[model samples]
Each structure stands twice: as structure tokens, then as C-alpha cells.
Target: MTDGILVVGDISARAQAAVTGVVKALEKAFNAKDPIALSEQFALRTSWSNAMGTRLDDRRSIAESAAPAMEGFLCDSYARYDVVKLLEIAPNVIAVSVAQTPTDSSGNPIEGAWGATLYVISEQEEGWKIVAGQNTAVESSSA
Candidate 1:
């Protein structure tokens, strides 16, 4: 393969990994209900925004945002994430389109899926950190 093509392939691979790893870490964090583990994956200055247009720009605020859903919920009942699309928007920026369907309280698939969550991932010295993101609820799911 040409040097240019080889370089492009490498870049793509790295992007893919960054996107995949970040998504997986999110999933693992929720699945395990391990906030500290989740915190480790994010940068100290991470910013998280909720579906309601609320934004949390600090670690304390981020934890506060995630605490509700994770609290009292069984780790086994968490949802799994599937990446619908992964795009390399910039040299170290990745956009991940992920679909997440919550299972019932008993850890079984719910009658219908909740919705998809879109995430913007950035490469940090520690790892992939979510500097900004937004989520939308899918109300028209046929299930």
C-alpha cells in the first residue's frame, strides 16, 4: 500500500479505537455502578450535559448528574451500548452515535427500547474524555 494510504488507515484505526474504548468505558461504568471507575476515564475538567439541556462542568457536578440513575439500581440491570456510527471529526476528536436500551429492573430487556445517546469524545492524555455531549430520547420506537 502507498504511504499515504497506510497513514490514513492508521489514523482510522486509532479513531475507531478511541471511539470504541470511550463507549465501552461508559458501559462498564454503568454496568458496574462504579463511579470511581467511570471517573478515571474522564479528564479532571470534563464537562457533561444532560438530555434536559443542563450542563455540568466539574467532577462534582458530573457525579451529581449520574448519581440518580445509578443509585439503587442493580448493576446487572444496566443497559448495553451499541455503536451505530463512529466518525473521526478531527485529529483527536471522535463522534460516537450509540444506541442504548435499558433492561427491566430484573435485568431483562424492556418491552421497548428507551432511546439513543449521542456522544462527543476527545482524546486526553489520560484517555478518551467526554468534553461535551447531548442526548435525545427516541419516542417513536416500534420495539
Candidate 2:
């Protein structure tokens, strides 16, 4: 990987903005602890792998499971998401990769559990939605 952020292919500013909006929206929903909203960002029949490598089979199950997961760790912490890269794979599809870190709500750093997520977004009648995604925990560099 290069030192600078790598954005491959051509996604116009507007399209890029919209494609990236999915991440922003996910961040907002997670921060707000709105699992329903968060799950709504995904495609109904698709799957997502959480940071723990657990496969979530569908939207309903994701939403069902996310509520408590949010309350458990996320509701008490502040999260930061950085887009590592975005690739335009097709006319109306793009893949986004992100780095995520979080601290306690008080801003105290929590050791470990850093994560990287990849989201494949596709255009829907409503807007862009995550057609597929995977979130995996990253070990500390010194680990």
C-alpha cells in the first residue's frame, strides 16, 4: 500500500460523496445506537461479517443482534472512522475500506480491538446501500 490514501478508478465528487455517505451514515447510526437504522443500510438478503469474524446472515438478524451489541460496547464509547480507500468497481457499484478506532465516551483510549471494514455499496432505488461487507479486528502493530 502507498503512504497516501489510494482512490482508484473515477468516482465523481458527487458520486464519491454519495458512496461515502454510507460510511458516514453507518457511523452516525452506530454512534446513535440505532440498530434498526444501521441494519437498514444493508441489503436485505445479503450478509456481513462483524469485527469478530461472525457471519451475520441477513438484515433482520443483523438488526436483531446489533441492538444489544451497540449498547454493550459502542453506546459507551466514541468511534472514529477513517476511509482508507474507495474503488469504483462498476458503473453503480463501489467498494470502501475503512479504519476504525474508538475510545471511551470520556475520551479515554481503550486498548486493542481496532478494526478495518470493507463495504461494497450498490445503487438502490432509494440510494446507495451496503450490498456486502466485512469487519475484522486488527491487532496492534506491536502485538
Candidate 3:
């Protein structure tokens, strides 16, 4: 017997592409250590939490908070972001999950520094902007 295909509700491909594009932009900005460009990916009034659990509200706060890290300890660190899942929660709103792997200056993956980030993005007048997000560190299990 032949198996039937499964369908998971209707989601616009255009919207998915746009949302993915925004994430790609963020990854690019982060790799470049450009705080301004990174903040531009978020909405004016946003709720964001970093891996260290620091909460930042609004784009200005996000920029201010990230600038120091980008120029300090994290200066030589880079990361690769991969969109793991995308769900359309509501019209024009998308919930996205991404996996992040920290890497060194030479693109070597850092040990035990993986992270996962969840972002709630909305399609605004300008484009898809992250309205809320939280980044959590993924602990490595020792066998």
C-alpha cells in the first residue's frame, strides 16, 4: 500500500523566505561584530534576552548592551546560525527557532558553547523584524 503525504497547515512561502532572510541578516551582522546592524534587525520596542539571561527592552537598549560584548570578550568569537523551525503563530507573525554554534576567529567550532534562540518576528511596514527573542545556552552532555 502507498503511504499518504502529511500536510501541516498552510504557510506562505514568501513570508517564510522573508523571515529567513532577516535571520540571515542577523547572522551576517553578528559575524561582522556590527552592533548597529544587529540592532537594526529588531523592532523599535522589542523584548530580548541573551544567553546569559540579560533582558533588554527596545532597540536602543539592545544596541547599548551588545556593543560592549562585541568589542570585548566576544570580540574574537563568531557564530553560525541555522533556522531549525518556523511556525506561523498568527497572521504576519512567525515563531522561529534557531541553533547557534560558536566558533573561533578561524571558524573552528568552540567546545560546549552551542546555543538555541527563539524569536517571535512580525511583518512590519518596513519588513520582518524581531519583536521578542530569547537565547539560551545549550549544555553539552558528558558521557
TM-score on alpha carbons, each prediction? 0.74, 0.85, 0.88
> Which sequence of candidate numbers ranks them by TM-score, best first?
3, 2, 1
lDDT of 1 at 73: 38
lDDT of each: 0.65, 0.78, 0.82
- What ranking of all candidate models by lDDT puts the best one first? 3, 2, 1
- Pick by TM-score: 1 or 2, better one: 2
Error of 2 at 118 (Å): 0.7
Q: Give the TM-score of candidate 3.
A: 0.88
The sequence of per-residue lDDT tens digits that candidate 1 reaches over residues 26-100 is 778877787766656556786666556687776667676666656753434576676766655777876667777
- Candidate 2 yields a Cα-based lDDT of 0.78
Candidate 1 TM-score, C-alpha based: 0.74
Per-residue lDDT of candidate 2, residues 15-75 (tens digit): 7777777887887788778999999888776779987677887889889889888888655
Candidate 1 vs 3: which has more lDDT: 3
Residue 28, candidate 3: Cα error in Å is 0.8
